[model samples]
Target: MQLKKLILLVTVLAGSYTLMAQTDKNSIDDKQNESQKKIKKSKTQLKDAEANFLLNYYEQDGDHSPVTGGRGTEKLENVAPTFVVHIPLDTVSNLDLNFGIDFYTSASTNNIDYFEGRKTGASGKDVRSHINAAYSRDLRNSGNAYSLMAGFSAEFDVTSFNFGGSYTINSKDKNRSLSLDALYMNDSWKLLYPYERRSDGTNWLKDDKRTTMKFGLSYSQVINKRLQALFSAEVVSQTGLLSTPFHRVFFDDVNGIPYDNLRSFSHVEMLDDNRLKIPVSMRLNYYLNDFMRLRTFYRFYTDSWGITAHTASIELPIQITPSLIASPFFRYHTQTSADYFYEFGQVSKAMVDAKETQFYTSDYDLSDLSSTKIGLGLQYSPLLGVGRFKSPFVKNKQVQFKSIGLRTAFYDRSDGLNAWLVSLDFAFTF
Candidate 1:
């Protein structure tokens, strides 16, 4: 069924693109004439609109599974496909649309029914779909622009609605800029608990809503012809139902009560419902001669739950040929654990008895950890098209192949988890 759904989705997207291409071909002449008239009235001319498509695949395997009290299978796989379209409404206004879907399966999520006495547990696959639309307008040629966006996401057990806006101001020479953005989201979830813990199967969650608000500010400056820098800061706050209901927590001292079909006694995970997060980051890029460039990034993050993290990364892009580029990158990150975090089957009776420390979790993701990732990528883009062929259905309309890219990466964590990923991207233009 999932494969069928994926195939149907791809077919619909392809059909839509074909229809759009035909429509654009039919209206090209009218649009060109209209654009010429607008250009004659204004000094600045509009550029051609563009559309892009991207597809990604990822898989991972690890031994720690939070659903099994942080020590079981943590295998997962995911595939995502996305499409973006940008249209110029006028010389100073534009509209953008993005649509995406993700299909994922997790062995850890399947452990929610581990006690059901099944060899592999129940199905843990789900599909998520989302769309975003935005409109941006230049207030004036003097370097002021504003944009507004709305987005929605839906999955089997969760739905989210988001709204956001951004304002940007650029210096006269366009070498310096500042941007401010604000966003709000409302997420609703159908809380599903572990099979053995659901008392009345129907009475899963009393409150299943989460609300988040975020604000961001950024500044970019061009220091010289070859160097540029950007700094950004963000504040995020979330409230209500922040913990996963299905994740289990085991105590060191068992109370002689045995869980059904399981060797260890476990309870549903619990934690505080409110959290606040702040992150600040900076990026620097340098162009060296005509064949090489360097990019560096650093970030510091902290949260009210007593977690602190640091991240740093660097990438170097080298031009192998006029039409080919190679980039290699590495990143490192480390974080302090949340105050209420405990290992699998390691929670003490004293901590459980104390009301203040009752808000605890055995989720490894909230524990102290260090991680590293390294990757390489190659891109091929020709300066001039090899050739262009007219569309069979639209007279005088031609399309050209643009570029291709391939990337692979390896990720390792201090907590005995590792993963590898590879991806390919292709682009075309009309």
Candidate 2:
């Protein structure tokens, strides 16, 4: 069965912000002088509060499932809905809130009780809920900003808590910027083992808690009027129980055990308790014309677990009209297998007895593989919004139906795993 909390960790780390680095340096230098002359000392007030609702659907299938000794159905489906809102707290500060829920089912996880000829108690279906909030403020006219954030997530088998903060500085001209971020997360797991192994009375793991710490740095620069680039790097460290207790690993030399009785020759997945990872990436966006733009990204990743990887991606966005934009993108990624990874039944009891196998796993997610993803995204936005209504919270104000966005993608992995994803977004301003 899949430990869904592991997937949540990846999702949390993927959060990012867009860089608005634009420099039309010779932008009629006269415009800047004239704007400064017309301006007076005043407090920065947000004209409107912003909000968005997002929904996502995902489906995938594969042949290798560690829960079944690395050979079983890996079909899964998930739907997630999220909401985000930002409210102006004062003239220079704002509060942001985000919350979401994920509902999912997995055939692989259902097989967790296969050996017992039962499926009702397995993680066949589940739901996760999460919430996060942040408070941010800008140093008046000092080109500095800072934010503090806190979040929590929970599911049937795991619960997590996280806290973080960020600081950013921008050049006076607003064409260059740097940001630093730090986060710490702690998780407590409700230990569950393979159905058969649970009755064996063996303490498979010494700990059921995990902790992660991450630090990131990023810089963005605007080049001339047509190009902008961002560079980022992050270091992540994790410790404690890192392996799934329900994942099974089979050995080849199990005294000719029947194939149907795989659990008799299987052991729980094992791995090191500590890990460190580093990833560096760069993104470049080029303005080709008023209607088209090109965006490119590249990343290099490595970890203490003897895995290295590279990823590259490109996207082209075309403006069909003043209110419509279409973007198509493609990405490719390749990575080496972890040192302790092995296929089904590739290990032996003799190796373990002789201390030749201190750590091992049959998880294909850690195996050598390549993947490709392609997608198209569309956004519809109008200058005056599609609809408007009176604001309920503010006097003499209106709420606007700002925009709608949709994106769909297909992913293919060399290991016979394939997935599809679709997402929708609704944006509003009040």
Candidate 3:
């Protein structure tokens, strides 16, 4: 039969030539593993552009606030000045960049005698300033990241901008991180005082403006192996000039001014307050070993006619060696004002009826506040000759708290007590 049909046609041509020689050795081992992963990602992006870093600072803020009888504790003497900068690159190339700047000023005339302003004559030396800037980067390796922020200020007539980004998800092996933010703000309000005298005159809106839109969501987790947690939420929606042209609202059934035929004036007439605000935050970290470390945080606030708030913080660190360390912190605050507050010269409505104030005026942001604070901070450095400080509760042989340079924090708060605060931080690399 023709040699058994030529042995089944050479066994189907030797099984299709060994399946095309193993598909050409898997296409030449996938092009030599994509050309050695693009030459190891171009030598890790040329050693992460040669890594970099920079830092600078100047700080002061003493006698923060402490007033009693002496006219609202003389506005707690505000002396605030700050500055900082940082840069880094070369963590094996995964894109990482950062920028910074923040400035604040206080001529501290006890914050203008805590608002009385010489019984009503408001002045701010010219202007109070607040500035900000930020930046972040990292993408490609997939676990993306992005950030941006802007700032401005002048008695809340500030301007702000924001942007955020984060992503990272890995299952089974466990890994999570997600973040989002988008914020915009505008604020302006300069109470009345300049107008050809008219029974405490001052009208024609100063510069009232209010605009807001904020939203955020965050997450990070690792509940074990040293503990860690983070969660966040935020929302805000405000609408234009929420009234405060100096502030003074009383009708006592119309003693004088509140709508035409006006007269009563101490301040306030820039009407327009449409708002909605909400904030929620949380953070926790624990690592009580090798040198102890602990942190906690919480925040909750609400707005929309009625107001509510809460805040808490805690920190603890004690490492005397390995470069020194010291931390002792505590914070707590409470709020419940804005239902229409008052307390100064409160009874008005008889300028033949009223210019403002009588059960729905005062508005010191609705008065109702509470506060608390205690702190201690210190950090010394010398590159930690190697290591020091260890007592995860007390494990013997580990008593560290050495000093080499700078690190200080001391603050006391309760509205005033002569308000005091100080902070100085440091780092170095080359």
Candidate 4:
């Protein structure tokens, strides 16, 4: 009986040790699993942080442009250089602050040495400057975005203030980029006119003042991974002083010297009616490949002056190789004459006498005014390195360096005025 009892106790002791060993192995397995999970989480976090850092450092968007001639609604035919800069906000939130300024010199754009015109008063060519700043922000809802912009060209003669916002709605896929935006622009149009009067006949002392408010809306759709289409429309409403005072006009009733009729003066008329205009535009962009692309657009315009026109333009960018490219563009425009447009010395004898001339007259009212523009230029972005700022920032391998656009236009007016307007643009990035 004592021997049997000893054997039973030994068996119990071995069973207890085996149970203990199994428990210890289970504990060790749990610890190893925890360590592995921690390592994987750390690696994922490191990768995410590295990507974010890269996105913030090297991302860049910039534009440098020099444009000369091409007239529309009192636009200058002179050449001007403009630079634009965009800096990232570097926050998780989609936000950015964009600021830039313009340096305008009359010497490079104008060919005149000096003229004592009634506008300049023999003061030689005047110089003008402009500055702009703005802030942009993203909305809490992934569909909305907005920005505010205000700037001044010259306090004395030029300044503008504007605010705008944009949004997209109810999209199935968040990866697809599609959105629409609307903006309002309010402005005073008295800038760039010289108020000084001197020996030169040109003077702005007796001019009518006008202010305009405009509304615009745009829609963009991503056709695919490589293509997009844009549509936009804008309307402008203008009121206030519409005519010039110093302008000369001779009435039919006043064959001789009249009490108010003026001689050799401006041709602007004073009218109680306000003005309204609408401009509609459409654009299509298609990427044939990574190195080739095509951009095309059509615009239609009309105003209160009883003028209407259509414009069509296209740009073809061909990649010669990886580092070099050539782009050619063409545009066509056709429009009717304004309601008040007239020929030289053409005035109504029945209207009230005024101090202004019947100078608003353009012989073109007898027919139609049409214009065409064609240009070709080369682009080079050689010896480039991959930008760490984004996954693919150095796209277009040849980035636009220098481009020259040459164009000529034709007009059919009663004054028999026909000429060609030439324009050129050059750009670079630093």
Per TM-score, the best of the predicted structures is 2
Each candidate structure's count of clashing pairs: 0, 0, 33, 22
How far in Å is the alpha carbon of 136 misplaced in model 3?
Answer: 18
Residue 227 in model 1: lDDT: 99
TM-score of 4: 0.57
Cα shift from native, residue 115, model 1 (Å) = 0.5
Candidate 4's residue-wise lDDT over 1-430, tens digit each? 1111111111111001100100010010000000001124442232121110000000101110010001111112222233334443533122222223222222212311112223231112333344444555545556555555444343223334444444444344543444444434333444232112222555433433445555666677787877888877777666654433222222343345432223233233333347677878899988888667888888888877777877787877777755566667676667886666543334564342463433243223212566555555454434332222222445543332322222222222222223233323232222
TM-score of each: 0.85, 0.90, 0.25, 0.57
CA lDDT, candidate 1, residue 264 = 41
Q: Please provide the root mean square deviation of candidate 1 (C-alpha atoms, Å).
A: 8.9
Q: Where is the poorest 10-residue window by lDDT in model 3? A: 25-34
Better of 2 and 3 by TM-score: 2
Candidate 3's clash total is 33
Better of 1 and 2 by TM-score: 2
Clash pairs, model 2 backbone? none
lDDT of 3 by residue, 295-323 (tens): 88878877775668777778776676555
Model 4 off-target regions past 4 Å?
A: 1-79, 92-124, 140-143, 155-159, 167-209, 225-227, 242-268, 271-273, 351-367, 383-430
Which ranges in model 1 have alpha carbons more than 4 Å from their true place?
1-44, 119-123, 201-206, 254-264, 386-395
What would the per-residue lDDT of candidate 2 be over residues 1-430, giving only the tens digit for each residue? 3335344464231133211101110000000000011224455644467888888788878888888777888888888888888888987888888788889888877887778877443348889898888888888779789888888889888888888888999899989999998888888997788888888889898899988888889999998799999999988888998888888888777546765666566688899999898888999999899888898998888889888888888988788887778888888888899988888878777888899878889888788988888888888887777689988888998988888888888888898988888888888888
**Model 1 TM-score, all chains together:** 0.85
